[model samples]
Structure formats: C-alpha cells, structure tokens
Target: MKNNNNKLLNQETLCIHAGKAKGDHKGALTTPLYQTSTFVFDSAEQGAARFAGEEEGYIYTRLGNPTTRELELKVAALEKMEDAAATATGMAAVSGAVLSFVEAGDHVIVSHAIYGCSFALFSHQFKKFGIDVTFVDMANKEALTAALKPNTKLLFAETPINPNLVVLDLQMIGDFCQQHNILSVVDNTFLSPILQTPVDFGIDIIIHSATKFLNGHGDVVAGIIVSSKENIAVIKSTILKDIGGTISPHDAWLILRGLKTLSIRMERHCKSAQTVAEYLHQHPMVKEVFYPGLPSHQGHKYLNNQMRGAGGVIGFELNGDVNTGRKFINSMNLFSLAVSLGDAESLIQHPASMTHSPYTQEERLAAGISDGLIRVSIGLEHTDDIIADLAQAFAHIENVTGKA
Candidate 1:
C-alpha cells in the first residue's frame, strides 16, 4: 500500500489504507500484530532514554503496541482527529475521557438520554466520587443552558441517542462548549464514522464502542477515543497509563481487519434499516416508528445536514401492551433477542428492560424511553429476508393478541 500524507483521502479509501504500516513486517500486505507484552531495549542508557521520553519506543504493552497503535491511528484518521487511544472496552473510553480532565470538585453535563451503561457511569459512578453531573435533554436549549455551571469541565452527549433514536444538534452543542471553554465529547458508536463524523461539527472528542459497527462482527470487545493530540496525550498518560485500560493487540488487530469492510457493511446496514423502518411505519401492528429515514421522524430534518445516513438502528412501539411487544420479540425467528447493535446478525431488544435497566422507571420515562418501545439493530442480511422475519413476528403477535 502507498503511504501519502500530503493527499487527503476519502472515507472509503481511509477505511482500508489510512495509518497502514509503510513497507514494514517483511513487506507483508496486512499490518503485522505485535502481540508481545513488552519490548526489549538495546542497552540500559537507551531504556532510560525511552523511559525519560527522550527517545520514541514502546516499553510495555499497556503503554503502547505497534498493532494497537495502527488501530488508533486508523480510527483517528477516519474521525478526522489528531490522535486516538484504543481501550479494552467502550466504558473505558467513556470514563477515561472524562476522568482524565475532571476533578472531584468539577461538574459535568451529560445528555439526558444515552446508552444504559453510559447513563449509569455518569449518574451513579460519578456521583460516588463527588463529581456532580446534570442530566439535561441536549435537544432542549434552555435545559442545556440552565444546567451549565462555572465548575462544569466537560459536556458529553450522543447523537441519534441509543434506543430512542433522538438526534441532538451537534453544532449547537459544539458552539455551546466552545463559548464556555469546556471540553465536548460525543459517543459516535451509533452511526460510526461511516455515517457521521462528530469532529466535523467541532466536537472536541469522539468516542466509540468498537464492539459494534466498527468491528461489524460479534467477536472482539473494544473501544476507542479520538481527540486532539494534546487531549489524547493527557488521557494516554493519565487514565490509560496509570489506570491500565489499554486494548489487547489481538483485539486491535481484529478491529483493524473489520475496518477494512466497514464502508460496505454500513452501506448495507443503512439500506436494510431504511426498508425495515418504512415497513414498520406502514404496519398496523406498529403504533409508531422512530427512524431518521422516515419523514415522520423528528430526526429526519437532520438527515442531510448533520448525518450522511440514518444509520441501522430503529425504535418503534407496538399497538398492544408490553406483553404483546415481548411476544413480538420472542416470535421473531431471524432477529435474535440480544443487546449491542451494528452486527452482521440482526438483533431485537427492549430498552426499558434490557440496556436501560440501570435507570429507574421514572428516569427512563423522563428520558423518553417508554416501556413498550422496541429497538432493533438492522444487520447485513438480505432486505427481503429481514422484512419477512419482522412481518412474521407481527403476524404472530397480532394473531395471539387479536389486536392489530
């Protein structure tokens, strides 16, 4: 592969060739994995120079690895950021980014609706450390304004928020953070860089659960944080270096391989999801559908301006009660009842009971995640088969409940 730093490549090209090793590993086509725990030094003086930061080299796997570095560089280039850090898991990216900058006395602002674990980490875990967090609906400008404080150090949000499919205005948040001189972090896990790049909107940091669309396969669990070179250096030296939330070289390598096909996989996911969402929107059994691809969706307005695509996830409500919804989920033969999205296998899950269980019922309702709402992650399956599977589930549920 040719390495050209002077020429800016498109996202599709970047996915396959960005940050690739240049004529290294005995001229191997693929980036070689450096799976060793630590690197050997030539002499004591050289080792001391490396430890002192006078020389550039890897000391230990936790500090850095060649394979992992490639993954970080690739993701950073994709997100159009200065640097990136790969973590053991998505939560690691979340916690590390915030903890590295904020102290116990500082306050933080977060999106009212986010992934269940992310909600827990901000609302519960941060509270334990005396770090006050205000959960405001980022869509509400007044609410966001009211939540800000002099002690606020960072603002965290997710676009096309998990399970609900609500889209927050990235430009608004970015402008707010810039005016306030506070760091802004966005969890780009839902759309990946293929559909949306948060950095384009002036977001200070971008985070991802590499376990999802980035990997495209339901195998390795990993996460990455992309940000400015200065911010990433701070996070790597503090949260990652001392706390040890580094990713395994093997997992990083797998993610690198997965990135090679991300563009095509995401294209298929979006195409199938749009069809599925349209189907659900017209179905008698579905009382409501939440997908940006549908004009009825509030997020539809942001389609062209804020996002390149509507992404693969869809949220909907059944006409019947919660039991009917459960039966609908269980009756599906093709869509597995599982958590996590952006996989090759289609998945169906209930937010109130599954991913968002960490939140209290009142909190879930306040955040607009209803008990009857069903979240589906559209996969790379044939569109006809995917719709047929959902069609059968709807038929089964309506037949048993006698309501449609």
Candidate 2:
C-alpha cells in the first residue's frame, strides 16, 4: 500500500502494488471503487481552482476518477512510461491516440497486419477526415521506408500482430520513427508489459486493449495509452476529453483487480500456448503453425530479441479446406469457439470469417490470414488438457474430411 517508486520492484510486485496507496477506509487492502459521477469541493474557490487547473483534484468522472487514475498509474508503471490515459474501449484508445496527433491531410504509416477494427479506423474513418494511411509490411524496412511520405507523422504497428502472429522488430521500427521524426506507437496487447515492454525499445507510445491480457479475465472492456507525460496531457485535454471515450469507474476497477494476477496468468498462457503450438506443428492435419515461440516461426528470432514470451495466441492452417477448419473448431469441447483472445479460458476462432471478415479475400490473404487458418488463445487450463482438446478437434476434422 506504500509507494515503492524509490525502490525497483519486480514486475509481479508492480502488478500488485504499483498504483496502490494506503486506503482511508479502515485500511482497506484493495483500492476502493469511487463510483460517483462528480467529486465535491470543500469551497467554491477550490472548485474554481480545480476547473482552472490550478489545483489537482477530481471534478467530474468524464475528466477523471480515482479508480481510473489508479489503473492508469498501474499501466504507466508497468509500461515504464511517464503517464497513461484510459479509454472506454480498445478502439477508443486507438482512435483517440491517432486523432490526438494527426489532423486533416496528415499521413500515417501503419503495419498492414493489424486488428481489423484498427485497420478500418485508419483506412476508413481517418480517410473520411482527409487523413491518409498507408499500410505496409512493417517487417520489411524497405517497404516501410517506401510507404512513408513527407507528411507522415506517425508509425503504428502491432508486434506479434493480431491473428497472424507476425512479430515486428520493435527497435528497428523505433529507430526508423526517430530518424523520420515520427511518433512510434505500438499496440502491445498481445504480450502485455510482463512479457514485452515496447517503451524499453524506444517506442514513443504504447496502446492496449485492457480487455485482453491486461485484464486476463475477459470480464471488462477497456483500453489505455501509455506515453510521455506531454503526449498524455495533449490526449487528455483534446481527443480523450472531447471525443468522450472515458472508461467507467466500475470497469476500471475490474481491470485493476485483474492486473494483480496478470503475471501468473501470462506465465500459464505462454507455457500452454507453447505446448499447443508445438503439438499443432507436429499434427498431420496442421499445415502451418504461427507462434513466435516456435523455432520455425519467421519472427521467432525477433521475438527472442524483444519479448520474454511468445504469448498465448497461436495461428495455424488446417491441411484440409475451409470446411475442415469449421469442423475442427466446432468439434472442440474445452476451447470455446469465440472471437476474443487473452482470457483465462482457451478460445478458438477462424479469422477469415470472424475478426478479419471486413477485409476482402485478397486483402486478408495478403496479410497472411487464410480461410483455413484458426487462431487459438491458450488459457490457464492444464497444458495437456488443452492439447487433448486440440487433438480431439483435429481428429474430428480428419474424420469429417475423410482423411482419418
């Protein structure tokens, strides 16, 4: 409950105690949820001072709350950033961060392999505002260099990119952005801060869908942007405030509760995902396995250099056709057939039909998202049971395809 900023604490310790302070309510161990819409000031002068930014205190929930502030502080500490801003949802964070920096006619370079909603925001929503976005294969420096325009203001990428699992070189991208005087933003939702901290690699901004690994329980939908205090102040004053993408106090409290066990959950997630990826790689029904932990993965070397773990998600293709993919997912018992990832329970989904369906077939395939591809989010369940569930699913796929 004490501020341990003076002493360096391990990540697990930071997860539990980073933003925590001794509670006023009978010495509560956990931070209490201040669920009110507005806070009262002692006097009119105090209210005026708070409104004028001359004093520091919570005025309105839309602007800030104690619970949300605590969660923001926890994330900022975990990410090793100067500060952070929490948003209503993952897309809110992504859109708010982009809008905070760029204006009409500004160009941004984005990794082609990104979450479908994120791609839509840049390619469609931003385009409507006269902003130009060029999606390039960020792994290829030449491609990234060619995609950049003189007006390019931001470079956004997702390492261990969603569904596809392509690991971008964080240091390389950071250096490129520095040389070009561009803000480097990374969506570190996949690995979380426990496994990878992009700020350590010189990334200017770190974004996350706290609904994923940060929460680790799949109970809350939230987002956060971690960056220099200056950038966060700009975002807080303009985009986050004006756009009204503020997270609710209760949701923030839930995410804060989930953060306490993030390290332990992530360890299980990484270990189980590694075992599952290896199992699928050797399975006759699986044609390809896309997980950074696998030595055969294209980005395994970069992952080794940048991240501490391969993360929980695994992308792989079935040896058979699209129907085979459907059968495999349908046959799974323990692994739920759902879209979201990074939960305590395993999840399986077909990206071509689910998360990436917004893109045309050519676009999806170009980004290495195939119809037969299945994405599995390994959970805290025993590794053997997880593998057995996958094996049973694969067997069902074989039987259904007449390949048994």
Candidate 3:
C-alpha cells in the first residue's frame, strides 16, 4: 500500500490512504496504535544520535510517536503544509503556536470574534505575560491595518468565526501579514481542510481542534498545528515538548480513523446545514440567521470565494430574550443540548451562557453574540428531522411567550 501518487490523488482518496503504510507484521490496513511511552533504540550510539537530533527515531512519546506522526503527516498533507505537530487539545495547539513564536513585549492582532477560550487566551493569559493583543474586525481592511504595530508578530483569525459565523478574507489578510513579515495563523476548526484550505491563500499556520469535526465522533480530544517544516520544528522541539501538551498515541489513532470519512461527513454536514439554515430564516420567531450559506449573511460572499461549501454550524437569534433562548434550547428533542460542535449527532447550545461565558456581556455583544443568540451544529441527521426539531423548539419558545 505504498502511496506512490499521493500528490495526484483526490481529497477523498487522500483522506482514506494518505500517511498510511503497510505494516511490517501482518500488513495491517489501518495504522496501528503504538500506545507506548518510549521507544527503545538498537544501541547506545543510536540513542545518543536520536537524542541529539542527528537521526529520525522516536525516543519518547512526549517527543514523538508512530501513531501521532502518522496523524500529523495526514493532516499536514490535507492542509498542504510541509509538517505538523499534534497537541493534547485545540487550545494547546493555539497557545503552543503563539507561545512558540512570540516573547514578552511582542504584540498580536486577533479577530474581534473568536472562540471564547481563544479570546481568554489572548486577553487574560497572554496579557499577563506582557504580550499585548489587539482585537480588530478583520473584515474591515482599514481597521486591520490600523491595528498593526511595529512589534506585531502575528495576525490570528478564525473564518466563519465561532458562534457568529463571520468569515474573513484570507487572501487580503495573508497579503498584509506577508508585507509586514508577521505570521498569519488561522483556526481552521470550523471549516476543516475538507471545506477550506487556509494554506492555499498564503496562511502560514493552520490550527484545529481535532475534538470537533476531525474526530467527528466526539470521542477524542486533540489538536494539531500545520506549517512549514522550519516552524513545525521549532514547535515540536520547544513548545510541544517543553509545554507538555503532546497528544497521546491512542487519541492520535482515533483522529486518524476520523480523517478517513472526513470528506463524506463534511458533505453531509454542509448539505443538511444549508437546509436547516434556510428553514430558520423564514421562521416567524427567528430574528436573524448567521449561516454563511444564507445569501443574507454578511460573510456569504467571502465564503463563496474562499471555501468549497458553507459549513455545518448555524447561528440564529430568537425573537425574544435570554429566557426565550434558554426555553428553545431546553425544549429541543432531537438536537442534544451540548457545548461542542461537529459531531455525528445534532447539538444545540447557548453561547452567552456556555462556550462564550468567559467574555463580558459587552464583549460578547461586540463580537456579535447576543443574549438571544442560539447556535446549532447540524449533524448527519436527516434534514427534515433536524428542521422539525428546530421548529418544535421554536414552538416551545412561542408557547412560553404566549404567541403560539
């Protein structure tokens, strides 16, 4: 099963066969989970060489593992990067990538609306370490340009941004970063490599919470950073190793299995999500729909230009208040009330009280997260059933408000 023509293989084929090699024992089709803490060297001289970086043999699981390496290779190939590094969690990938490059007194410009944890990482954690960060509306080119400073080392963005689904212009931002010599880091967790490839538009680093769509099953918690070999080497040797955020070999294996079905899964997710978003748009109780697939969405044009399909996640606002939002989420039957997205099962969550609670009310509003906002991660469920569940939830809200 040698991958002689991997470069020429289509994405679906690459997902199934890339980074996989026949086993030495029984020719196992799947990559084996080398669930061990350390690998033994043939001799002391070989061990010394491995430790000194003169040879390419795994010494310890913390530094590297066969399963994790295979997963990294698969993701790097999918993202079209030179190399990649896996981490314990998505936040680990985020923090590791940023910390690996910047030091005290450096500045970073980040999108105004990102995942709550990412916002906290920049605002609270990074600030304490003397790393200044400016949150700007990346869609506004002038604002983004104004946010740049002499010490700015990175420009961070999340397309079809979390909860709000605000898409950014990758080429525009990538060019700015290139001109300024600043690293452009994108959290491609929402779109994944199946829908959008950030590296194609000149993005320098790509990050993902393999816990989401990458794992699809919602069983494994992992993250990965993809970049050029030089950048990955620094992160692998320093940030990933010293910070102790290396992903477990077993977890890496689970993510590897998930990658095989990524293409088909994403296709289903996109199709179903479009149906759901369209249904919500015409609902009387719905205030607004924030899916990029919807022509009315502010990011729709950018999504059309940069991505292959609109993603599965959709955000909408109830025509009422926070209590109405809670009632709708609580009344959902088919859609599970959960925190995370990109699962095989439909999930609904209220970001103001859940994922984005870390942000103050004003900050949340600034990021387009309103109290009445509700986000749904459309899963592999049939489109009709998902829409019916949402319709019933809206009915529940209507009943509570005496409008039914």
Candidate 4:
C-alpha cells in the first residue's frame, strides 16, 4: 500500500510493501489485477507512441501489464537486479534467457547436474535448431573454463541443482563468462533469491520458477527473468515476444501475494529441513544424507560460502534398492509423496522413480542420485511433528530391512 523507494527495505518489509502504490485506492493493501488483454490510450498519437515503444505504457497483456509489472518489479527487488520479465512457466524463462543471446550456430556451456527439463531443452531442443552445448561439472572451475569456446554465448548453471542438490561455483563461472563477454544465467528456484542471490556474484541473469518457492503454495505456475532493463528489452523483443510465453495477469497477482511471505516461509522450510536431515543422518537404516546444510555433506562448506543458510530440501539414501525407496515413500504417513518440491506441506519422493526417472541408471549415478535416495521438501509445519513422522517411517524401514 506504499510506494516505498527504500530499495534496501529488509526482505520482510519489501515482501509486504515493495510493489504497492500508496496514497491511492480506498486503503486496500493488496495489488489489484488489471485483467485486460489490451489497454485503451487517450489519443491516436499516444496509442501510436505506446505501440512504437516511444512512450512507456502497457499496450497488451502479452507484452506487459500492471499486475505482471508489480510481480516483476517485486522479484527484481528481491533478487537485487535492475529489472525483471515475467513468463508463462519456469522453462519459458530458461529458454528465453539463453536463447536471447544465442542462435542456431552459437554454443552454450551447461552443468551436467541440472533440472531434467532444462537439460532436455538445452541439449536436445536447442540442438534441433543447430545450437551447440557443452555439459560439464559447474563446480570445477578448470573444467568450466575449458568447456567454453570462442562462440559460446552463455554459461548456464543451477546451483544446488534440482532434486540431486549439486552446488556450482557461481563466482568462478561468473568471472569466466565476463572475460568472454558471455551471459551467466542461473536457475535460482531451489534456493530462491532470498536464501542465495546469484546476482550478487555477478551472474548476468537469474531465473526462478515462481510455481515453487515464490508461490510458496503450488496454486500458480509462472517463471521470471531478472536482469537490467537493457537485457529485458533484448530478450523479450525476440524469443519472448515471438514465442508468446507470457504469464497471465491473474497468475502474476497470485505470485505477488505469495511473495509477501517468502521470507517467512523459507525460514520455516529450511529450519524444518535441517531438523529432518539431522534425524536421517543419525538413523541406522539411512545409508547417506545429501542435504547441503549437514556438515558431513560434501558440499557443505561451498554451500556455506555461497548461500546464507542451507536450503529447504533434504536428500538421503536408504539401505535397500529402488523397491525400498518406493516402500519408504509409500509408508510415510504425515509427509505426502509427490514429485514437485517447495510447497507449504511436507512432501517426500524418490528421484529414481519420480522427478528424475527419465534419466538412465548411469545418468542418475553421475548426478550422485541413487535409486535408494529420497528427497523431502520440508514445509512450514511444526518441526517436532515432522520429525515424529519421519521417525515412524524410519522405524518401519529398519524393522523390515534391518538397516538405518
């Protein structure tokens, strides 16, 4: 409800007040959606200027709208970027961000461990259009530099990568891309900009699946690309406009409402995840735990350096094989077994059978995801209650398999 210019408003304050216009509207606080396909201008000259991009104004929902602008500006502020562009879905943001600078013959360097859909889009879909890609360990600075080419247009990565939770060296990747004048695009959905900001590390662009953390509830589907106004103009004018992947104004409004509590929700999720991860690590039937928060995790220190705190997902391996993993997920009482992550209710799933099932066995192994591994999207529920549910499930697992 306030036109707060305080760009440095604490995240909590920004969540509630960042995009609001005060001194207007009968004291209603929330953003009202301008649910229209096209806006009418005052005069023919004004309409011409709006269409010509000579004067800044919303002409069509497909190009931009007030509700969508509120959400985009809020996210841009959250990620500490100059501007942002809202899109139809997470993949749309990914494709639009990279394809903005790349073309049929240009090259891209990507991490091996990443969202399956993103991998498919870059390595498979882009290849169909003659775009080239080199996949390597994004954490390995030497390998990342070596993977680059004279024609490489983008250095793409997802830190604490989807499902498996691999951490990439954002600073190194950012530096290398800068030296080559290439864009560094990061998928910040897992950690959200609240937990870790890739932009601060010099990443050229940041992408988020608002369907996940930003929504904080699984009701809306959306994505966003946050960068400077210059980059937004370049990307949206081409791939985003021609492809026609824009988020509806209503969905944008929902995302804005959800963002008001992002800081509150994330703190709970990460805190719950830490509790559960510790329990899993100490359990006898648990062979291994893969949460970045745990000190024993291989990437714990790297995570500490990059993120403000450990994230909300906890990944662990069971004593048995794929069937055991399925049984563990099915036997859980309190935690729902689902494919998607970053919801308000706790969810558990086996990557081998659910989210990453499309990957071959070798591919899963390469990503450090095993058939016995389970991932939990910790929610904003009572920690002790969550731990109790996991404890009961582990007890059953150990009774049947005689392992922790």
Candidate 5:
C-alpha cells in the first residue's frame, strides 16, 4: 500500500527503508531477486483481467515485473513521488519525460548548458518533429521568464549540471513554470534526492540518470522518472510503454542493492569533493572554479538556501592553452581519465575533448565549458590521499607549464 504517511517521514530514512514489500519468504533482509523473465498466470482469464486493470499482477516482463516494480516503488518513495518508472538509460528517462507531455506543436524551455546528448536531442532532434525549444540561461531568471512562450508545455532544468556544477534555483524555476501553467521537469542527477528533493519545491516531475549516483559503483545503467500518480499514468501508458525503454530484471536488482548505501556514500563523495575544490581554488595554476558551495560561485545564494551539500563534481580551468587541459589530465597519478561521473574511484576528464566533444568551439564557450576546463568526479577515496594525489599532479603540471 502507498503510504500517505510518506509526507511525514524524513528523506534519509526513505533511502534505506522505503518500498519494502513483505511476503512469506522467511523474513529476508533485502528484496528477493525475482530473476524470471515471464511470470506464470493462473489462467487465460486471470491474465486478461490483469491486462484490463481488473487485478494487479505481473503479465509480461516487458510490461512489468515484480523486481522492477520494487525498484520503481523504492525510487518513487525516495524521490517523494506518487509513482515512478525505470528506463534503460539516463537519456531514455529524459526523452520519455519530455515526449510524454509534449506534442508536435508544443514548445519547451530548457537550460542552455545541459548534458551534451540532451542538447542535441532538444535543439536538433525534437525540433525536426516541430516541437520548438527555447534554451535559456537558467541562472538569469529574468532571461528565462522573458523566453517563455504561451504554448510552452514544459520547462526543464538540471542543477549542479553535469561536469559544470551549476546550480539552479528550483523554487524560482518551478514558480515561474506554475504561473504559466507549464510542467517543470528537473534533472536531480547531480545532487540526487538524497541532498535535495525537487517535489518539495513544487516541481511537477523529477528525473534521474540512476546509472551514476543512484547505483553508486557505476555497475548498472538505469533512469527513473518520478511524478504524481495521475501524470505518471499518462506517461507510463503513452510514451513509456510504446517507446519500450525498460530496464532488465538483473539491472533492477543491482539498483536495489545500490540504494542501500546511497546515504553514506554521498557523505564521503561530498566531503572529498569539497576538499579537492578548495585545493584547486587556492592554486595559482587554476584560473576559475565552478562549484555551488564556493562563496565565489555565481549561484552561491540559491545553492546555500536550497541544497544541504555541494556535491561530488568540481570544474576548473587550466591557465594555459587547450593543450593545458591535456597536460592536467595526463599528469594525474590517482585520478582516472574517464567520461562518466559518480563512481567510487576518483575519475577526471577533459570535458571539451571527452564529454562535450560533439560541440564546436563556439558551442562549448557558450555553454561555459571552456577550452582549458577540466571536470573531476570526486569519489569515495581517503580525503587526505585524494588531496595528496591532486597536489602532486598540480606540481607535475607546474613543471610542464612553467606556472603555479
């Protein structure tokens, strides 16, 4: 049974204890792994009744499964939503959430600087279908408000946006969207629901690329869209099923396993990332640092008022040329040069060349992802050792560049 008591419970408790289904399985500690692809039905009539919504039970693996439902329920509970749907990947969640609410003639407003794939999907792909999109600087609320169209069906935002660590004022964005009677979709991937809940700020829909922080270890790839039950039904029945972006039973099990440690893992990730960010801020070799927690950051007030912690990613620019980005990346001893973030081991990468390589020089500059900018996804390593590794790397970088 969905608990109306959900409103009173603290979010930290939900992470560990929400979405538990009791059955006659001899008191298991965790959700049982129902690894079967297809479930057996009592009779053809029963199966038909289940499909017709007369009774609630598993029919086909593609449609729904017990394991997938558990994951959905748990994520929905954590996100403070009525229901949720898990998808094959992060982009699948974004695409489904967007297309579910919009039509060929509708319009959307999205943050100008977003995930690279999302950028292409909105400006290039969705436009082909005649869905006009307005990319706005979410930091500048005045600009965002001026860009809103009468036919805007949705307003999208990502806080502490991937690699960039740019924070968005959730309440400000949500309020503006509500005034215009438009749905607000927030990508809570960077902070996760552990640190901030978008629903609390009146956000209509919350999306997560569960592959990263939700899973914690970078082993599984999944996405979740959480919203009110009424909206969820429209999404689940329409684009969600027809588009067919469902996660496998094994991946669902993996996500369930990952949720158990989300709280403690985030604590370490936040602590270590702040340590690294502070170290870089004081370094002469670094020109600028983009982290929400830093007082010098543009979104400091919004971040302070809204979020509990800064988060694991830190973006800084090298003081030299484009080759400086390469020197900084190649000089690292502990950090691995990788693309994806929110893993247990410290991974760093040159976003200009690695993550946002699809964008041209002008495009990258417009997004605030500079040529010499390097993004590091701080992981759950010993803080002192992580700092030591980066300090040595900076020393090595100074040797190569004759600065700092």
Candidate 6:
C-alpha cells in the first residue's frame, strides 16, 4: 500500500490494492474492519493532544474511523484527488460539499435537472437558510453564465443527468468556474469514478452516492467527497463534523469490498445499457430514447471527450400516455420497480412520480422531464433476457393501448 507505483498500475488493480492499510492484519489479505465506536489512547495527554490537533489519532467515531478512512483514501485515489471524506449518505456528500463553502446570502448555481432530494435540498432547504439558488441548464453555456451572481460561490451538476441521461461539458464548466472564482462540484453517482473522473477536467470536487454504483450491491447507504486535502479538511470540520453526517465503518467496509469489482461491473453495465438503449430506440412503442450511448441522444457527443462510458441508466418516453407507461413498468418481470440504480438486478422507475417528484410538474416539465418518461437501470442479466423483459413490457403496453 505504501508504494509510489500507484500511477503505474491500472484502475482495475488500483481498485483492489490502492489505499490498503499499511500492515497485514495478522497476514490477512483483506483490510480489517475497525468496528469499535471508540479507540483506546495511551494516556489522557495523548487524547487531549489528538482532540487539540497537536497529534494524529481517532478521537471519536464522528470525527474519524480507520475503516472509513481507508474507503475515503481509496475513493480519493480512484478520483485522482488529494483526499476524500466519507459520509452517511449521498445527500450528506452533496450538502457537505456545498455547505462547507457557502453561507447565508451566498448564491449557488445548480443543474435544472438533478436527483429529487438534491433538488429539494437546494431549492427548499437552502431557501430557509437565506441561501439563494439558481437552477439553470448547465448544458447551455449562455444560460449558465446568465444565472451567475456576484455572490455565486459554486456550481453543482450531474453528468448523464439523473432520469434524463443528459451529459454536461465538464471542461467548459470547470473553466467557467475558474474564470469566475467559483468552485465546481459534480455528482459522479451515475457514472462513478470507473466511467468518469471529474477532476481530470479541472473540477474542484467530485461527489458520489456510494449507495449506488460504488456499492453495486444496493445494500449500503453511503457517500464520499473527493477534493484537495485542504477542502476536505474544511468539509470534515464543518458540515460533516457539525452536522454529523459521518458514515459507519461497516458501510465503508462494504464499499471497499464493492470497489474491487468496479471495473468489471461497469464494463458489463455499459455494454448492457448500450444494447438496451438501442433496442428501445428501435421499438415502435417508444417515442424517444435518451441515452448517451445512442448517437440520437443530444449528450452522445460528449462520449468521445468527457465520459468513458454511457453508464447503466436509460430514459425513454412511451408512444402513449401516463397509464400506458405505468402498465409497461408494472409488466416487467425481471426489472424491479425501484428508485435506486447500479444494482445487479435491472431496475425501472418513473422520474415524474418517483425520483423527480420533489420538482413541481411545471418545474419538472421545464427541466425536460416528461410525465411519460421512463428510466431503467440495465443490470448484469444476459442481454437477451433483459431485452425479452422489455419486449414483453412493450407488448403489454401495446395490448393496453391498442396501438403498435
């Protein structure tokens, strides 16, 4: 773990070995989980020194834990960041990254389309604290520039945006933020570090909902923020320490285990998603398919530059109404009707009713989220089986609508 050869290793190898604890745990191959709530100190002076920032050691679970620290280090390495801080949930990572920098009277510019809870946190929660938020289509350079104010401190957005699969130009956004002296934070949950690393485009911070792609098993609820060590220290000391959004060591351990297969998992996810998107695009019952992997998608152009892969999610509108969309979703046997994504099992959800419900109908529509839009997370299942499931669902919709 203490090698300078990390840069020489491939991502697949780094996933397994990077940030591994220094010494073998009694010759065990895996990193030992430090599950205790508290650690023993040599003396009262040492404990005091640790708390007073005069020494380096764990003072409490809220402040730090060895297991969580390993996860943070691993994620930081994967993201090509100086450091990272683990959190209890993805929203914690989002809130911590934003709140650590801005205060009352400050302004933030966010992508018009984003996850529901994040939209709520910025639009509703921040307003109560006297913080101003401007929701703009980050894909539009002029609109993003027009929304900026003198007090705007940061820009937050998601690439292959949630429920819509809209990819943003990271380099453009990063350059804009730097020119304006504002920070840039991106939600890498959809693509994870395996498919996209925002830091490579000069982004200031990268955030992930480890609950999604990073965990890959859908069992853990966790998050991480990667940035400069200085920014991480600020976040850990502020929103993470004061607001108490620390991740448990057990969740951190699960994520560490999940990281080992990330490269392979993403490969399957991308390949499967591409096939699924293509099928949906050609289906007679589908009105439009939105996936970066498809040449028809507006975001597809970024595939050659910013994103390494199109990811596992796809969004499409049916040729019929809301009821038809509902029938299609309920008709699927293999794809689970669930809100979360990046699981082994294929999952589907309605963004208008499920994930983007936090946005009012008007807001959702304005952001390009239609009432009939259906989103799916293509899983590790065989492509034939996955397509068969979708075909049956479409057949159900056809039967119900008497169309196609």
**TM-score of each predicted structure versus truth:** 0.98, 0.98, 0.98, 0.95, 0.96, 0.98
Residue 34 deviation, candidate 3, in Å? Answer: 0.4
Residue 27, model 4: Cα distance from true site in angstroms: 3.9
Backbone N/Cα/C clashes per model: 0, 0, 0, 4, 0, 0
Q: Pick the candidate with the highest lDDT.
A: 1
Q: Tens-digit lDDT track for model 3 on 76-167?
A: 88887888999999999999899999999999999989999999999999978899999998989999989989999998999989989988
Span of ten consecutive residues with least summed lDDT in model 5: 1-10
Alpha carbon lDDT of residue 120, candidate 6?
98
Tell me how candidate 1 scores on lDDT. 0.92
lDDT of 2 by residue, 145-225 (tens): 999899999988999899889999898998899999999899999999999999878899999999999988888889999
The reply for model 4, stretches above 4 Å from the true place, is 1-4, 402-404
Model 4: per-residue Cα lDDT over 64-129, one tens digit each: 888898888888888888788999999899989988888888998888877778877876788688
Ranking by lDDT: 1, 6, 3, 2, 5, 4
Q: How far is candidate 6 from the true structure (C-alpha RMSD, Å)?
A: 1.0
Candidate 2 regions exceeding 4 Å error are 4-7
Q: CA lDDT of each candidate?
A: 0.92, 0.89, 0.90, 0.83, 0.84, 0.92
Worst 10 residues of 1 by lDDT: 1-10
* lDDT for 99 (candidate 4): 83
Q: Global CA lDDT of candidate 3, please? A: 0.90
Error of 2 at 333 (Å): 0.8
- Per-residue error for 178 in candidate 6, Å, reads 0.2
